[model samples]
Target: MISASAAVLRAGDRPYAIEEVILDEPGADQIVVQVAATGFCHSDAVARAPKFVQVWPLITGHEAAGVVERVGSEVSGIEVGDHVVLTFAYCGTCSQCADNHPAYCETFVQRNILGLLATGGARATAAGDESVGARWFGQSTFATRTVVDARSAVVVDRDLPLDVLAPLGCGIITGAGTVLNVLDVRPGTSVAIFGVGSVGLAALLAAKAAGAESIIAVDLHPARLELATELGATATILGGDNDSVAEQIRKLTNQGTHYSIDTTGVPEVILCALGSMRARGVCASVGIQTGDVVLDGHALSGKQLVSVIEGDADPRTLIPHLIQLWRDGRFPFDRMLERFPFTAINEAEKASLEGRAVKPVLVMS
Candidate 1:
């Protein structure tokens, strides 16, 4: 058994307890990663909600950056000492994955959300030999080390800052991928992003990198709006005036934006996003829904409302593209990052929820 120090979530209403746990041996197609850093994401927050959690003692950090410490016997194309970013798991043989759309893998829910292990046993155990759920997004990275499926690891250059690149796995990829792959945002196009959090801001950066003529950002926080404006949002809206929000977007872009992205997951905000799109424009919904989206019969007349998972990205390709963009100084995603020690996981989570931090990265001690 491998020993690891992890932040364990035992219940929805409780704080994460940092404890030493025993990790199972890597499966034939899995690898052991020594986590350097991990990002705090909204999905982790959702997993903490009692209604969404199907199991207790779950470890749910998904955006992880690490160095491979061990490779399973059957693992290929990756080796120990390689720098890697851990992403959501997918069955490589699935139709969606075969088509290079791993985000829509048929077993996504079972593998990513359920933390299912093909080895037919728990991935880790806490004190007293109690089982712990740790395969979250194929890598329960709220720890110093983790076991992950080989297919979910994307190897990157060793010289890159692991702490800053940690979020590329999920939040960053989700936003950028939706714009570049799903919407095919072109030069001189217009886009409006709802919610200027880490994900939304990532979209803003990608839109700017794509040479979008007009980039609008909407959020409830003035600080975030200010940051968005600094980071290249052509305009920023305070986001409470639902009726006027769409009208304002239309007036700015001559006839609404060509594309829009919703990362707020609030039903009203989603409607506002749809309303801010021009006729036949596409709006990608990537947020975790808090309430049901009740749409009017004519709400989607010529506009398209799409439910996207992880920006329809194949991490192998998109991650490298993003890295290149970053190297070119066209995508400055690091402007939104804030770091905290791994021992301060609770503090980092609180800062994320309170909007004090945009992308909080937990660095291993």
Candidate 2:
């Protein structure tokens, strides 16, 4: 067993508290990771709401990167001391996984969100021997150390900075993958992105890398808009302005964008994303919906609306491609990262909620 300090969220409405936890040995298909850092995602915030809290005394963090401390007896291709990024869990034998769509794996919700272990046991326990939901997204990386299925670990170059690369596991992949993998955004095409937060900005950066001809970014925050402008957005629209945002994008792109992406789940913003696209253009929705989305039948007359999960990305392939782009100075996702100490997890979460930081990473001490 291993002992580590973790941020424990005992209730849906309470703040995370620092506590010493006990970790069980890795299973035959699992590995132990000494987490260097974990990225804060909006989904983590969503999990704190009353309705979403299925497991009490949970340690919820999805995006993480670290060095492998131990490899299970049956683990292969991955060894102790390898650098890896922890992503969502998947059952390798499932049809979806066999088809390279692990994001849609049959047991996705069970393994990733419900915090169920394949072995039907808890990977971690609190001081009183109470089981904690430590398998969140298969990594539960809010802690300094975690035991995770080998299928969830993506090996990366040892030289890369784990803190900066942590977001690649989910948010970054969802954004960039929507453009590169799902949309197949080609050069000389126009695109529009709604809600320029970390995910939207990542999409913007991917669009730029894909050689998009015109990129329009729409957001409610002027500060984020300015950052978008700096990060290669050809045009920016104030989200709720009296002017029609879709029309503005249409005017900028000589009719409408060939593609659009909505990172904000707001119903109105989604409508604008649909309206901003040209005939037959596709729009990918990657955000968590807060309320029901009531769509007009006419909205689908000539366009397509796709609900993308994890950007339809195969992480093993996409992450390396993104890393190469970063090395070539093409995909600079680092600009969106803000590092915080693991002990200041509550502070980091507050910053993320307040928009004081784009991507808050918790670095283990």
Candidate 3:
């Protein structure tokens, strides 16, 4: 086992506490990643909920970018010292994984969300061998070091800064993927995105890349709406200004948009996005919702609801595409980042929760 510094969440409603712990060595198919940076995704906050997470002292950040320090005996197609971005876990043998949709893997919840390794044991231990739930999303990346199966990562360009690329693993991918992959927004098409958070903003940017003519952004924050416009939203709607956000969207786009994405996960906000869709339109949801989405049956009049996780992305292929887009100046996701040292994680979390930062990257180096 290797000693490492990590931010531990002992309770859902409390801040993470930095502590020293013992990280177990990589199993046969795992690799030890020396974390350079990791993004604080909203999903990490899910691990703090007592109703959702059963593990104690869990480490939950998943969007990690780092270097391979050591490889397990069964590892292949990866090597030591390679730059990489960590992603969600998947069981490679599942039908979804075999068909290139690993995000929907049958064992996804068990391997990633349950905070348990496939073999059913904790991977980290504190003094006196107290267990710490460390493998959240197969990464637990808010640490100096982590062990992951080879399938949970994508090798990235060595020259690019890991901090800037980390969000590609989850937030950026989910948003952009919903646009480019799931919705496939085409030129001259119209789209409405509710919630101009990291995911929504990424969707807006992807809509621009897809040549969407009427890209609308809806959010409560004026600052976020302004940023959305700067990032390529054709129109911005102040969520609270309108009597009905869905009506405003329909009026703006001439009888609703062809595509809509909701990143807020609020039931009311999702209803608005759903209502703002054209015939046979698609609405993709990427937010974390605690309550059931109670929707009326009449709302789906030829409209499709896509409850997607990870934007239906296979990280291995999508990460590189996003990186290339970044290099080509098409995807400027880095503009939404606020960098902080690893020690100041609580401050970063507060910034993210308070909407002061769209994407907060914790630099571990």
Per-residue lDDT, model 1, residue 133, is: 90
- Local accuracy of candidate 1 as per-residue lDDT tens digits, 85-167: 99988989889999999999999988888876444334789999898898888788999999888988999999999998899
Q: Estimate the TM-score of every prediction.
A: 0.98, 0.97, 0.96
Instruction: lDDT for model 3, please.
Output: 0.87
For each of the candidates, the C-alpha root-mean-square deviation to the true structure, in angstroms, is 1.1, 1.3, 1.5
How does model 2 score by TM-score?
0.97
lDDT of each: 0.91, 0.88, 0.87
Question: For residues 236-298, what per-residue lDDT tens digits would candidate 3 score against the true structure?
Answer: 889963348888899998889999998888877777888998889999988876467777877
Supply the global lDDT for candidate 1: 0.91
TM-score pick, better of 2 and 3: 2
Which predicted model would earn the best lDDT?
1
Residue 150 of model 3 has an lDDT of 88
Regions of candidate 3 where Cα sits further than 4 Å from its true position: 119-121, 241-243
Task: Give a tens-digit lDDT track for model 2, residues 240-299.
Answer: 952388888888898789999999888778888988888999999999866777777777
